[model samples]
Target: MNVLEFLDSPELTPGTFEGDTWEPWRAVLSGAFGLPMDKGRARLFKRLSGGRKAPTSRVRELLVLAGRRSAKSNTSAAVAVYLATIGAEMDGLLDKLKPGERGVVGLIAVDRAQAKVLFRYIEGIFDASPVLSKLVSKRGAESIDLNNRVSLEVHTNSFKAVRGRTMIAALLDEACFYADENSASPDVELYRAIVPSLATTGGLLIAISSPWARKGLMYQKWKKHYGKNSDVLVVQGGTQDFNPTIDPRVIKEALEDDPEGARSEWLGQFREDISDFMRRDVVEQAARVEPLELPPCADTRYFGFADPAGGGKDEFTMAIGHRDGERVVVDVVRGRRGTPAQIVEEYAALFKDYRVSRITSDRFAGSWPADEFKKHGITCDQSAKPKSQLYVDSLARFNSGQVEIPPEDKLITQFCNLERRTARGGRDSVDHPSGGHDDRANAVAGLLAEAATRPANIIFECLDDGYEPEWHPYQMFS
Candidate 1:
């Protein structure tokens, strides 16, 4: 039986869905899969159609873009389980597996907590069904083993974790926010890693997420492939369109407070508040394939800048660089998290190693940074401008190809994700997207800005103090 039918069966939900509890989803998926729909649903389908008609062909891939509380996670979990079970009856799903190999159905989420939510839904569905439950051979915190040699696994979004698996199907939940705490490009990296594995098995890949920024793999796919008549299907809808059960007042309050965010979260539109400040291609073009870590050179004068965090949630980052004639060459970048005193002491030692005379820092913790550096006999100069200005100045260097960046993935990700926001007054500012960090980028910008703008420290002295030269208009002209 199909997933929607199974959901309505007596063994599963019983009589919970009476009239049109699932009618919207039924129409959507029927159109997606090219199955016949009832007249009412068919009309709804036509109204919701995008670039092409609902074809009579099978869909090989699907991308569902919907608002929050729109039954996306539940629908994704149901579809994943269906592919792992009912779809298994098809040829080549289990036929290609070796004697000791097992087919896997993967459920990936933005984080561990989100992954667990979907895993629980899948687990509950299996445990509640008598027929489906008989296939269970083992169950763990994040995986379920069936007697038929198939495994259902749950994981946080990561390319390394998903590699080498022979998947029957994979469900990516809330994929727009797939970035981990430390990563900047989780969506692209994870997607690229999983696609090759699917090629061998012809497994279905479903990415369901609420609309986010106008970038990343989700946005790119929708921009390029949505409404196209192909194996890939991109479905877009708002909260009311998909799940009318959500309270209208909840969405109303959200819209009244922040219209842009509300539209992205509840209306299923990409945010106008979010965009890239520096293009990814520009950043990549300027970065070295492999970064260099150089020891202190006796001839070159080095400089350091720190973008201090409280050492709590954010990172305590520092950048070290030197002016190479007209250009700034970044030598090293370091970040650590700890108590304020501990971080200060660590940076003190690093400063001594580079023979740094003075360090520049943002005004973090008021006068504490200056006071703490005093303990180490180092002068901490607070920047006159905000971090946004630092990014703006650094952007010019990047655009002119004057600065060569290190090959740090985190640094590159931060730069790529940085957004240039223009307020209603025509004032502009640059910063990272929500849940992202720009500590490394900030530190580097500070270091490069000083290098580009600061003049060389040259002390003038007179060797011929006893002699004075005569000044005349004719002699000066000659």
Candidate 2:
């Protein structure tokens, strides 16, 4: 039976989907599978697809742009189940696999927790149907082995994990929000990896997510294919468009409070104020492949910066750098997760090793960072500029090829994931994306800005005593 027939059978998905609430999604799936639709659903299909005619044959790719609380995850689970069991058999996908090769149906999400939600839904759907339950030969935490050669698996947002797999189908839930510690564009990289796997099986690829910034793979696909008659079918709708059960008052209040955010969360529209801070190519150009960390030089003066955390989820990070001609060379960057006091003491010792007497940091814990560093004989000076300004200044350095960074994975990822947003007041701010950390990036930027802007020191020896005093030319005596 086809997916539409399975959804209509109460015995197959009993009490799982409401017909009225899921009508629009039903129309979407009908168009995706090239099934016939009624006049009403056909109109919705055309409207959502940018006035294009419904596909007469099954499309290889389907991109769904819908708002939050639109039941995207549940619908994705249902589609994955259908594709893994009946869809695979119908397309003879299992027969295409070589001997002893298992065909996989991958369910990918931004993180493991998010992926588990989709997995549980799939499990529940199978358990509700006695006929479908018999197909499960074995069950694991992240995978389900079917009696046929196909298996259902859960994955986080990483391209490496999906490589070398024989895939029958791949579903990317919340594809627009995919971020990784090692990749600037995790969704695009993961998509590139999955496409080849599906080539041998002539499988389906479905990506469903609420709209984000006008960037990344989801936005790009929507821009190129939403209203066109391309092989790839893209559809977009709001929360109420797909699920009318949601309260209108809630959406109204949300829109009143934050129009830009609410539009993306409730109206399925991309935000206009947000954009990427740095391009991947720019960040990669500043990184050196050899010498992950540089030792202190006897003749070079170093600048130190730290981003302190109170032994919580955030990491306490420190970066040491020095001037190399006109370039700001980051010598080393270290991050530790432990008691704040211990981390401060460890960083202080490292600072002294590099002959650094003073370090700069933002006023994170007020006088606490200063007091702690004093105990270790290191002077901690609060930076005059905020973290956002530091990032703004550092961007110029990156763009001008004046900053040299080590090939640190976390540092590169943090730099590439940073976002620059324009506020209502017409001010621009730079920082990491939501649910991301920038401890290392913050420290590096702070030190780079300091080193680049600091004036050169002039030293003079006292005539009477063999003592030398250093001073900046701009210094004035009272």
The residue-by-residue lDDT of candidate 1 on 1-478, one tens digit each, is 6656766777754443446757777776786567787778877766555645776755777888889988888788777777777766553488767789888889898877888899988887887788888888999999999887788899988888779998878888988987654466788888888888777777878899999988888898888877777777787888998888889999999998878879999999988776779988888887877745667765456778988887666788888887765567788888788897888888877876776758899755477887888898678898877899989988888888878778887888888888887654568899887667888888998898778655443222212321111222332110
Q: What is the C-alpha RMSD of each candidate to the true structure, in Å?
A: 5.5, 3.4
Instruction: Report how far off residue 468 is in candidate 2 (Å).
Output: 12
> Candidate 2: which stretches are off by over 4 Å?
457-478
Residue 273 shift from truth in candidate 2, angstroms: 0.6
In TM-score terms, candidate 2 sits at 0.93
Model 2, CA-based lDDT: 0.87
lDDT of 1 at 282: 86
TM-score per candidate, chains pooled: 0.89, 0.93
Look at candidate 1 and tell me the lDDT of residue 441. Answer: 88
The lDDT, on a scale of 0 to 1, for candidate 1 is: 0.78
